[model samples]
Target: MNIKKGLVLGISLITLFFTTPYTPADDKREEKGEEKKVYVLDDIVVTAPAIISGNEVNRLGSQVTHVTMEQIQDLNAMDLTSALRRVPGVVISRHNQVGSFGGGEGGAIFIRGKGSSRPGAEIQTLIDGIPKFVSVWTHPIMDALNVDIVDTIDIYKGAQPVLFGNMAFGAVDVQTKRMKDTGFYTGIKSGYGSNKTHMASVEHGGKTERFDYYLLGGYRSSDGHRVNADGELQDLFLHMGYDFTAKWGMDLTLIYTDNWADDPGPIDLSYPSDGRFNNDDFFMVATISNNYERAKGYVKFYSDKGDIDWVNQEGTPGYDTLTDYKNYGIRARETITPWQKGELMMGIDLDYIRGKARFLHPVDGNSAFPEETFRIFSPYASLSHTFGSLDNIYFIPSIGVRHLNHTEFDSETAPQAGIILGIKETRLHASYGKGINYPGIYAKVQDNLWMPGDNRWSELEAENLDHFEAGVEHRFSSKLIVDLTWFYDRGEDRIVTSPPPPFPPILTNIGEYKNRGIEGSITAIPISGLSLFGGFTYLDSAPDDLPYAPEWTFSAGFNYSPVDNFQISMDTQYVDDQYVTSRARMRNTVNTDEVDSYFLVNGKISYDFRLTGCDADWQVFLAAENITDTDYEQKKGYPMPDLGFMIGFIAEFN
Candidate 1:
């Protein structure tokens, strides 16, 4: 352990020493007291910053990436996973194998090219103020939820304010729509896409006197392109708010989701593969909140249950089973004050999870049940202060600690700090923080497969990361805006699994690695009714090879409104070579190959008209993806679909 820690620190120091950019924190001490702009990084871009900006670009402590609800609606996005594609520093991957290997579209979302490498939860997710992480088996589990429920998504890419508590390795907070004080709304939408995919949804909201409420429901199903690959999804969601008095208020929400998919066999090139796979999931949540002048807080509870069935043809062994999981927590936060120059926020949170999965071998009628459970208790706080000429600069520092009751892991504390500096029209920012992820039920206790006898949860290892990021954001004119960021991450004691010899070969022991990258983006509203947006990402990852970790990613788009009710838009994405791994082996032993980079183009056109009597507006649109139909592969032996089309319509009430 001593030698390993020494090596990790040594490597981190060497890597950091070579990559650090000299940004000259002092403007007055430049070149023997002479002031002249000298380039630090080879490439620099200037652009209008997004309305919701971050500290990374401004020399502040942290950074916040923002996506507006307006943009989400414009794209007619199906889910949060689909809508995030437009963000600057994100990548989405799909496994397009033949039969049973294709149910995970919109299942993988990566920020900074580091997430989604293995099955276990790699990042922390949040809705409102709640901390959430999906089970490894169903990565990207929120796909069934509609994006219409979101008011906006705020991504604090690096470390965040202290109030967030531990788990900032990539913090993402989603803000749901709030009830309006005096208006009513109703909307319905339906759509059809290639491969027999269909979707329909309805949502309504209103306020009566002092009470406001909203309800949403949707159904979607698809007979996918591959054999035996089909899926069906249904969702119901609600939000309500009331004012008990002028100084206090409460909000409530309830959600239920069900998903079922026919498993397609893994990739088969020779003939065709045959197999059966299916899954079902259920979820529920309730929350209550209060407000008082300068302080506010809330608490919520969550629960879920799911089942899975898998079968192989030709007398081969198959598995069928049901799984249940339940989680409940109480999270309360208070905002101290918004003084003349700065603001302060602090909070406390706690959570507990209990889960179990049962397995059955159908051929011999054998069955077993594995007990998996854990409880997590975390209490954290943060502080933010701003001061400078005209309050143009701000600094934020945060810290958090968590206690675990599990035997495989020990208690841990995480601390972070960042600063943002504004000079004239340009801003600079930098921040550093630590993060840790706990082992899942399957990794430490049970291997799910029948071949196990107390694999003993392979001593849990905490992954510690120190992130250093800096960037410059500038706006030279009204029409053009540019933003650029550079980031370095050092991961210690990275947990990785080894292939089985006498034990079920799943994720196993403690490992380590390093990741570093740069990102840049630009948006231009050069002319009235015409707009352009584009961005690029460059990354390098080490140790275990990851399939979706592309070296280069780029995207560009143009939107134009030719007339009052008609609009046209086109976008393109470019992905460079990536890697794919099939089995466990030395990082160097695996066969290395390229995915052949390609550009994908998509276009859409829409027209809006009014419907009589209902006081409604109608929209009709068509979308063409992969206009070139360029063939590509994200996983070995699996070819993605070509030239897909989708047509959709929507109605909204005023």
Candidate 2:
């Protein structure tokens, strides 16, 4: 670890020394009205500073979906699941009603048919470029990711070793809001919906000459659609930034979430009692950044801690479980234009995690909790070159590699490359990459205890994936744009559960799978104040019947403002039939069968008004989800709510 750190530091220093100095001549030209143009990364699209760029998105080497704050507001999204479902190639499954406990433990997001029932295994979630996942289960808590506090979300649908290390089948980077102007602003929002659900939030931000800060606090509660399926959640987010110089700055972020829910056991179960669980989580990150004319860099340190408690009320004397987890990490990255038409990026990541799970007996004493610790180190680099245009066409190519070292497993390397060709308003791109996912703590422990005879624990290795993709993007006119992409992924030595006759299931790395899909999207502004968008996806997988791997998914939406200060929007989504297995199916207790395909319609309307004699704006809105009241089951025995409505008002003061 020390050696790796030393090497990173040495390289940083050398790059710093070789950086081209800012020249007075450049400043003079700018002062004389010759503004320097920003060089955006090829094919990348972003509304804020990020590791990737619009050029990168355009290059089509990798498939990316960029969601902006405006879009979130338009949808009136409450959480990650709602916002992400609108993206092509992305599918989110939730159990029970909207805010029920099953929504957290049973919910999952699949990107190009890659995600598993487990959380953090298939996709990695990041907050400001720092990973956020429970150390104990190694999965993301979707409820904890409040959409209100986020400014933008960048979704990468394939391997991204250059910017993110392991578990990058699908990666999401969430950037929070920050104050930019030297003035104070505040906002308040509140709403109510079906099942006695209610939500409220307050936010404030300000910026001064050298400092800026943002704060938000919110709460949501619901009496779920099902019996004994109630839940409540509270969250807080804070961000502060300070500028030390014109080219250097530092930022600090803190987030906390408290959630409690009651889980109604599976529908087929005859149990009369309800199981309950609670989670209290906290996260903090501090970063220092440098932004020069031709270079950018940042160093960050982060910590996450969570406490979980669960009570199973299936029997007269229920059992209780408690789990505690802690994780800390450091991340550093630098990007520099070392020469004409060329850019280089390098980064390093280090993480340490510890967790313990305990079972408490009511009459007897509590059992000893097995505590475990893990450490990981990763270093990576990427280089890209842009070839000058020929006949008004431009070409760019890039290559990257990442090496990961795990304390308990063999080290591995991931490599990736891509090329993009662009002419006028059209771009064609292709890319190939390798990715890896290590065994989660739970998988590791289960292998050790249940598979001791086979000693599979000692022989367990990281899962590997190879990804290939090609795509094209075009802007037919100022009013219309379209994107189409095709992707293929192959996995080997995947960790899966094996249930043998008369024996409990065990974790083993003996699974192989394949997924191939085509995703397409189009956006059009047919007239002033009117916007239309639609997306569709087609997926084919090995085992051809993998549950929740929908063969077809489609969505279409439009936003229109017929008059000033008023706006209306509507959207519809359709999903094709897919196989699914429920507790009843597994136990042969009932035949729930495959999940039936369904279609849904949603709509919203809002109007803005000014506060006379005050620097403030007030808005009132009404929104409805599942307006069609479609009967659907993303998860069996967990029917979704039928036609939920919310009425809310927002006041923004400047």
Candidate 3:
């Protein structure tokens, strides 16, 4: 059905569900000598809390943003791309739609105009502090991680702290849910919208005196808005924990995703006869944590595995490529209160990875590729001191360093320092840090395959980055808060793909890039039931060739509830003109870059209610995205979908 019909049908269903007649169970209860109880809609309204607590935000030494589960639900976000775009200084690129596969080529996220042309390269992604990406290629598959089980997301815009290692130019940390109370609960959410898209999810969680468990499974499929673009995804996540004693505990997490997509190619080209991509990814992590009066620590072991296959049918003889990768790592960290108002932390990390790539010829069935293995060890420490308050003012300073040892490269050291000053309702903070990015296995193996006797591989060195940031936050009153931050990053010896005369393309460290930007945001509660939020970013890059780096971006939104049980929310985002390389031009002839810009508006309405005889709280919501039906492209030649609508209901029971 078309979007218009789907929206009308969805609204009709919701109204019918709310107003349908039913036998009053309270009457039967009264007949049985029990008191009749009535529930008012006012009591059912739920107001979401702030994304991050004030205390938590103040304790961090770096620039950070948090997205809570409540906010995710309010936005009707089904994936990371949808949810992360709301954050300042973040931009996301998707080939066509969610669940589509483009290898390490589909989606890219840029932060402060710095991101790898390759996916997941510029930013590090972690789940519960464990890295989540293909170790061989050093990139993440957006669809491989499920959003249904997430409880919160923490985003670090620039160089991360010492606790995280390896690629930390920017970081995204995903935390899953854990049972809070000792009771069983189950929920199901389903929705349908334009482009023949549909989604369904089931979740259950329970806790006992000594143990707790949570599980979620979901599936999404869509016949995309473009021709030959169809995708499907199935994901499952499980989390369990056991408390052996008051001070010791163990927990385990497992995730699996199977995704498939058919590439439609560029809009300017004819749809291929057969173009498919498939991936089966798995991740598991187990941890043991201890809590003592003076110290706390955890030891964790994690494993990630991925199997992918891609086929191109446009060739004379359709060929397919297959990749298999496995990565396992162990991490340990301890935090100790060394003295009054002082703390120290230390950690160690070890990782091992193996990967193999195969190219299959349709006629010969000959598949062979090199298998590579690598190991890494890193140790880090940090110290912090909090001085006694003077005249109601507080001061804190911290420093940290990490030493990395790699099997194939020279050792490297990274250092960071920061300070925070607070007085009354205002805070001032500044920090400086250094980060490094090592070459991935793909580059090493590809060098061996294409250039057997070249010394270019050995000459490659780890890229380095220096970050500096300062910010101030003020709470004008109980209902208003404002924040402003400035950041500058300089990168040296950056890796770039170079195709020199009479030679194949090779990875080399031959470029330098820099970015300086400022971001500001405000949150205000004008009245009891109304909230307002808005943010803007101004970015400047040294080079003019940076693709997809917009100079100006702004977002504004508000939530209001005129009635007790009904809420209305609206948000708008503006992206200034940015450069993008044309996908179609590259394939057909010489590559060309183009500039594009767009504005998007979205709105939602929700009603909360509880049936008189039911023990569940229900919320029905309708959300419209891109209401203006603006025609734009995040990636040149790949036009994003026009106006879309989704109507869904959420139910919770205990």
Candidate 4:
């Protein structure tokens, strides 16, 4: 640890704590009788700051940053990875301009230097609180996350075992959109951009006294900027709900997506090869929820199934592999306010995974495979209470624990605690949590067939993480806010390959690593319709030398509406040079290959207006990415696209 830096930060926090002005809380708040607050990282992003990736502090008082739909539009992002590039503590990598890479390191998202592990990842993705990923590979399928259906994205910075388990060392959850007002509404969007990129989407939503429904469908394709590097994506989703009573309701959601991408090898390929990956995914989530004066809870059941087919055209003898997977789970939680300023919460999560993979055309005597199942049952509870006077300063403390039971492994227990202190517009928070992750079924399948003698895969223990974080946020005015956070996390018993070479690759658990960092952001709206934001991240990792964890990251952006219907937005970022592939991780050998640091700027301009006699509002925008046309590469041999232009329009009406 850097003692000097630590001391400086400590002194700064103390100084801020003493200087912030104090104000009394409002005791006569409106009553929410028989209406429980379902805190699904809950926050309605009705504010204007969504134009830039922004932050929010939930009732829990820890870090829970977010990016709203308005923000996604400003960036003209069409996919999950692209949509998160500007968020603090997040870094994304990809090979092509339009489509996400499937087999290797393409379309990967890393937070605070974690999630670089391929075939298995530390970071997880969720849709409406339901986990979604390429179960066979134990990682996210970037293309499967359709941004057209997302309303708000919540980012949980570090290990949050109490709230989310297993793959949630770092997590991003996309909350689906729901109709807010009565009557019916429809939205249509379309765009055309460089590299022959084309995209279109349509959505309809409505809400009544007792029923609400939302439906969406979209398609996008690109003849990428490189030879044989084309991609296509399509998606359909529907959501319906019926309120049985003022305090009880049920809802169901169905999602489907089909996408494919082609890899044109490296930039300078001596011997060319064509690699294509295709995926078809479908999932559903159903929930029965209730709210009351003293208690609120919901039971959610979800199921997902997907197939991935990878055609590797290595040399002239190309081969293909297909992986089939299915996932089912239930999530239920309840929160009860037993007394004044006191509450208790409990929840359980059950996840089951089953899958099989095999080569379409036999190779190295590796032919068929048998299906296997993995189950996870975890239950958790927590309590929180407010202390101090409502007329002055106040404090909130929280503690929680979770028990993990896996069908294929021994059970484990994880715990967490947190505290929040606030006065007026300033807040301070601190937290600690433990994270655990077990190897995916992919590990066992490989040992069973490809390497016949390696039957010890099932003997590996789950990995563990110790996470800690502290932060302070101060809102000077309705338009200006500043947030600073310091975090550190340590890993132990991480599984990695032993003697990674010509001998024999054996999976083992002798890896350990730790990372510490400081992240801060400032959002300012000096005048009406104008918002400016900037942020930076500094990270330091020991002995392990984590990959894709840039030591320094900087981002800045601004959104301005000079007139009622005219807008301009621009975003810029700079990332320090860092290693690119999983080889830098313990799964293989750490090497010296690294990518160069680069700076980028992107801009968008739009106008919104309503036809003279029509009630519908229409918006048209022109977006340009990589305005500087700087040459940069997130991975070796795969250079990102230069300055590109996109023209798009949107129409909405009731």
TM-score, each model?
Answer: 0.81, 0.87, 0.88, 0.91
lDDT of each: 0.57, 0.71, 0.72, 0.78
Best by TM-score: 4
TM-score of 4: 0.91
Tens-digit lDDT track for model 1 on 290-324?
A: 56556565556665544444445322556554455
- TM-score (C-alpha, index-matched) for candidate 2: 0.87
Clash pairs (backbone) in predicted model 3: none
What does the lDDT read for residue 334 in candidate 1? 58
Off by over 4 Å in 3: 1-46, 49-60, 103-105, 270-274, 313-317, 361-367, 452-455, 501-507, 581-592
Best by lDDT: 4
Q: Count the backbone clashes (under 3 Å) in each candidate.
A: 28, 17, 0, 1
Off by over 4 Å in 1: 1-60, 95-106, 132-140, 159-168, 263-267, 270-282, 304-318, 338-342, 363-367, 389-408, 447-458, 497-509, 581-594, 612-614
Worst 10 residues of 1 by lDDT: 27-36
What's the CA error at residue 249 for candidate 1, in Å? 1.8
Question: Residue-wise lDDT of candidate 4 within 1-654, one digit each (tens)?
Answer: 012323323433443333212221111111111222221111322225633455755445558877878889888897888888888888888887777878456777889988877668888789988889877778888888889888878888888887788877888888887764555666678899999999877776666788877777778889988886788878878888888998999999998888888887787895665578888899899999888888898999999998888877553344777789899989999999989999899999999988888775535544756788899999999899989863468898999899999887778899888998888778788988888888888778667665535547777888888989999988787667888999998988887766435555677887888889999998887777777889999999764457788899998888888878888889999998988876432454674657999999999999998887665679999999999998998887878888999999997755
* Model 3 lDDT, full chain set: 0.72
